[model samples]
Target: MTVKPADRDFDALFADPSTRARAARGVSIRLSGLTRRFGELEVLRGIDLDIAAGRFVAIVGRSGCGKSTLLRLLSGLDRPSGGELAFGAGEDDDVVPRLMFQEPRLLPWARVVDNVAVGLGRDRDAPDGRLRVASALAAVGLAEKAEAWPAVLSGGQKQRVALARALVSRPRFLALDEPLGALDALTRIGMQSLLERVWLAQGFTAVLVTHDVGEAIALADRVVMIEEGRVALDVAVDLPRPRRRGSAEAARLEAEILRHLVHEEPPDVGWVI
Candidate 1:
């Protein structure tokens, strides 16, 4: 039997007990002795970590640190090679996960509205589908661009469209794979604000993988630094909204993370025996 057009509430997916476990309070993403290998090279080593639910966290590392691979594992886009990957969602409800990539990946031949509706499943005629698609576009400030094709929109707009597609699903957990890496500096900053706005309205469990230290601190509630395929430092940001780069606090936190990330040392020059 075909499911009723009105039956699926994208929000309901998170309401499930299992889904709640994945994003609700007291839950964590635990990886024990996790490792991944491609041929003879190990990308991720014996990894063990936990991420609290409903917290915005950023993972950063130099190239080949397997940061993207970690996000993919959380999103279920890929499985772990040698560790248990369990989400706290529940036994009954599947983990409602979504991934946003660096590229917009919108269909050039499809209308902007239709591209978002693709996440709503195959049927475009349902009322819920229409409502979801319209609301998503509006959320990204592109309600008026619904009729436009991908080729007509600017780079930022296309990326916004891609974000809308991800939002339409009301995912319980969001895995971001450097979603703004491709945009120019100014545009990237704008997108950062736009992302925060969406997250504020619709609070979801988010794990962002980014190379930009400023961007990570500006957007994440917690920032985790990964090195040698393992998390090195996990710092929490207790600051106000609309965090601006070059702010006193931002500068301090950036310096702290960078000291570990680049110099491979902590602030110990002043330490005394």
Candidate 2:
């Protein structure tokens, strides 16, 4: 597979056995007093959080709760008004992060491979670009559709291509903004499995923003609830991977998260700790 130009350092770390151990220790994210505002409105307010490297974190909230804004800042797509955002333990502290949105955002005129290649930016024309694109497509189970047009593929296929595009860059940080929200129920479940598999294989630090409490509990090592521009609750999900959706433990955790989103104020506040 061709190494993504931007991810050469990260990829190199994995290629060497000595560095591979270090690479598996995911990067740490530190945010202190993080704040963001638009005119008179504040979207994020004095937020502080720490994410262990290679861990999956899911942020959930109602609409307009500033979760998306926080994600934009984490992805470096938006600047924070105040606070420190730092990545720990890397030669280059700032790895180019990849962001996936609800829409596949594929170019209609570009073939599937080409669309995925776009993630490589100027590196798309590099000699190893084809190999890189092919590998990413195969990773997402879209190798058969690599040559097909985006318009010809189904919604799930397009999202798979989108995922391939997101992964093609070999990003150390993957920020997902409801990428699976548009899919059908069955497709959504399948994509969730695909996401978990890829995450486990790549060991990248993942931050997903979704309103689905169940989905958050199912995929995250920890679930953070954002309320009124602040972190209302941060809870660890101790459930094992490949969790049974209908399991009692899953249902209980889902209820715990839902309580925060549904209540104006936390119910029996002292009891929730």
Name the candidate that leads on TM-score: 2
How would you encode candidate 1's per-residue C-alpha lDDT over 128-217 as one tens digit per residue? 888888878777778789999999998888998998898887765778999998888888887897787566556676889998888899
lDDT of 2: 0.83
RMSD value for candidate 2: 6.3
Candidate 2: misplaced stretches above 4 Å? Answer: 1-25, 265-273
**143-199 in candidate 2: lDDT tens per residue?**
778889999999998998998899887778899998988888888888887788677
Q: Which window of 10 residues has the lowest lDDT sum in candidate 2?
A: 1-10
What is candidate 1's CA lDDT for residue 53?
61
List TM-score per model, in order. Answer: 0.84, 0.87
* Top lDDT model: 2
Output the TM-score of candidate 2. Answer: 0.87
lDDT accuracy of residue 259 in candidate 1: 74
